[model samples]
Target: MSYFDLSKFPPSSAASDDGSVSSLLSISPRSSRSIILDQSFFDAEDPSPSPRGLAEPPPQRSLPAINDALYSVQVNNRRRSTNSNTTTSVSSNYDSDSSGRSGRRPIKTGEMGTSSERESDGEVRYQEKKSKPKPKKKVSVVISGGDKVKRNGGIRMAPLNVPIKRRLQTAAVLLHGFTIPLYTSLFWFLLAIPLTWPILIPYLIYCLFSEAHFDGSAPRRRSHFLRSLPVWRLYTGYFPLKLHATTSLDPAKNYIFTYHPHGIISHGAFGHFCTENTTGFEGLFPGITNTLLTLDSNFRVPFYRDFLMFMGLASVSRRSCEALLRGEAAQPPPTWSAWKPWTWWRLVFLLPIFHPAPHYTAPTGGGRAITIVLGGARESLEAIPGRMALVVKRRRGVLRIAIRENAGIVPVLSFGENELYDQMVPTGGGMIEKLQMFVKSVAGFTVPLFHARGVFNYDVGLLPYRKEVNTVVGRPVFPKAQMESPRDGDLDEFQERYLAELRRLWDEHKDVYAKGRLPGKEGEMVFVG
Candidate 1:
């Protein structure tokens, strides 16, 4: 996988929403002490005297100037009282610059006064439209170690004035969003109690025989209704998730979406693909049934297995991959899956039966999509917020599969995935790293040492940090026609193209989608084996 490091970079210097402004802001803890700014600090009023030999430090290093800037919004806002802290707080620096945007032009006083009116009988009446002065730019300043966050406004959606009931409902939604993953184990653990054994035994018996563990195509599992529920919308919306498409896909084709840098969990993939009515995936790209693929191990989880199926999730395994993409229970070529032995009867059964997905069902189905979290567990170790690192150079499994299935590859990047949690990456080759590696070898996944703001506080919780996550879906890269035994070099070539597209997407939109991700340097997407 790739590598990541924690940044000492502060949030105040982050980019403005829409990237219209690039001012560096320093947000310190809210001090009760009144900030003092000397008149000489103003660059326009009194330029500081230059030293004989040494150059001056930049304006950023000057505390008085920072204070003056932090408190200068009072005059700009036309507040009568500059003494009131509310008028000049640092948060006001984040206000939306709507007047500067196109189309919605604010009226200017000069233009208003220029309009003249004529009256009958040589009596002329002048008419002037009153116009409000444009508001200054504002940005939300999240001060560390203090609850006194001055969120005056910038770069985020405007908060709604909801009733108390709605506020409580939102809280409930957040709580549910966070707890749903853990609830699976919790459900079984409760059922394990002696009094509940009767119900638990039958469920266990049913689960033991269920093909839901291996076959995602099972009719009962993929419930379109459950995927359409309001709860799923709340779950996805808790991140206030956004789904963007670089371009629409053709309904006649199948696609393979490879999601990068699997942050803690591929929550973005789930929010974007697994639910349709909520994230509006269907409305955006109609006629495509998208399956968000995951490690088969998740299908082994109690209660959670069923939920994954209901959400149209399937195993990201060799047999499962071939079946979903090609619409047949075809065992991947021996080169793809070295272990599974093949039989001719299985091939024979599929010769006359399959249609390729009709609504896009196999045989008559519209075409289908299979999304894989390309970076998997190893990459999660590198999932530090604000840094973009990917483990894609050696990620040829999905590419090979896509080539074999003739599925177009679509690169999906979640701009704020890593921001959901702060991870603790043990030093390379250190004991902790070795232990994590050992666990992954035996158990198929490694746990990253990670944490996020709690439900109660902003620093210790299982709930994902309440940062906006924008997932941009790029145009598809159509793989060469079906190759039963695709060449390794050809697969690598496709991967290079895929990686290039991902980098292109990042390079193009980082300013907007991942603004303030890295300061001083442009954010880089690294590819380590």
Candidate 2:
């Protein structure tokens, strides 16, 4: 619709030769006439024509001023359209036009190109704006595979298609876990049978009065056959345990091997020391007879006691430890003649009947070594997966024994021992912990509420997860000579040196062995009394 009334506002006297009003308006301001419209035209869409005096020619301006004003008006109009719901003021546009005529406009994001581009077609340049591309942010990604997996919150169910050999390995460990119960049940079952009383009664009497367990010249019932069983290899394979000795132990010298972080079951110590098939302890340190020491109270159990002695395990009692160490200096155990070729069939049956008494078959000679779990029962309470805490700060009995015997103290640290079980440990000084402590004070051992994988499922059972356990034996710390009466100061000095060696051993191999440790402070090696 036409808003201007052309009838009243005729062409000005200074119009261009073409007689066009637009041509006159486009002239340089210096030679241009002022064009004013009626006030009514701006107030309404249709307005009455103004008086003829409004058509009179006005003052002129230069061409440069005219061009600058046009540019300023165009820029102002563009800004006004971009901003929503805003009124444009003609006075402000004229003020800006009058202020600048030579300076270039500042560049902005998503704006038109350079001044050269603006000098061409303003409409085309405004349409061809350079849109600044938004910067892309980087993201980190993690990948999971067969060996390791991101734990989704749910029960970890085991796959059905497991190999038969792996299943057998799991079964072997399962048997070991149930040894005490299984043997005790068997003993009671046999006792229930009245016909077996004659043999069983004598065995019970012998077990009760047997100095053979504590006197420790050499374990009479320590069966080399049982220690070197193929089942031990399968048990080791369940968690795929390994042993690494930093240096060879001398055959002529006695050594005290102290194990750290007494895990719930101490599976690493059992698999490494008590069994010959796991890491070939004998092959690693030949001529040294190592006896794994356990609590003396364990000897009270009937069948389990015999089973432990069969695996070359001894009591950790003062008498037993001293006896084993003293036996080393005395005569070695008696040896039997080599088996003749005719006994090949009996050997194939895997029986312990022969009592193959080789000179080095038992903990005999001066080359005897005793392995003690230095942390004992208290440390078992801290057996959380991917974490370790040793109760060795004030426990100096084993160290005192080492000093008195003039034995080398071998520091053994087994990584992943605590990863065998998931335990529900109560917070320190809590009611539950107080109750646990009370039980421990009376029973000599604290019961850890723990669990792990099952026979069929990967979660919710007693079987330990398929984790790798690496037991690294550090260099032995020994005094200059034996001290039958070591002073408190001397004991302190020796213990500091021993503790230093233990910390060094941990620092050296923690990265490789404890890669899967829990995060933050809980994952660290804590020492407690």
Q: TM-score winner among the candidates?
A: 2
Looking at model 1, residue 410 earns an lDDT score of: 93
lDDT of 2 by residue, 404-451 (tens): 988999999999899878899888589889988898898788788899
Model 1 agreement with the true structure over 1-529: per-residue lDDT tens digits: 1111101123343234343223322222233122221112122321333312223332223445544644553444344333555322222333334565311122333532332221111111112233568996655444321223324332222234434443443474465555545767677687879886655555556555555445537322465666666666766766677888889998788888888769987778877887767777888888776778887777666566656665667888877776776555222222323232222212322522221222323433436778889888888888988888888877787877788778899998889999888888878589999999999988889988887754444555666766788988988987756787888778877877887888889888888988758774436677766
In model 2, residue pairs whose N, Cα or C atoms come closer than 3 Å (at least 3 residues apart or on different chains), thus clashing, are 29-61, 29-62, 30-61, 30-62
Superposed model 2: Cα runs more than 4 Å off: 1-153, 218-220, 328-365
Model 1 deviation from native, Cα RMSD in Å: 25.4
What is the lDDT, from 0 to 100, of the residue 510 in candidate 1? 88
Alpha-carbon RMSD, each predicted model:
25.4, 15.6
- Runs in model 1 lying further than 4 Å from the true structure: 1-199, 205-209, 216-220, 328-366, 520-522
Q: Please give the range of 10 consecutive residues that has the lowest summed lDDT in model 2.
A: 88-97
Global CA lDDT of candidate 2, please? 0.70
Q: TM-score for model 2?
A: 0.66
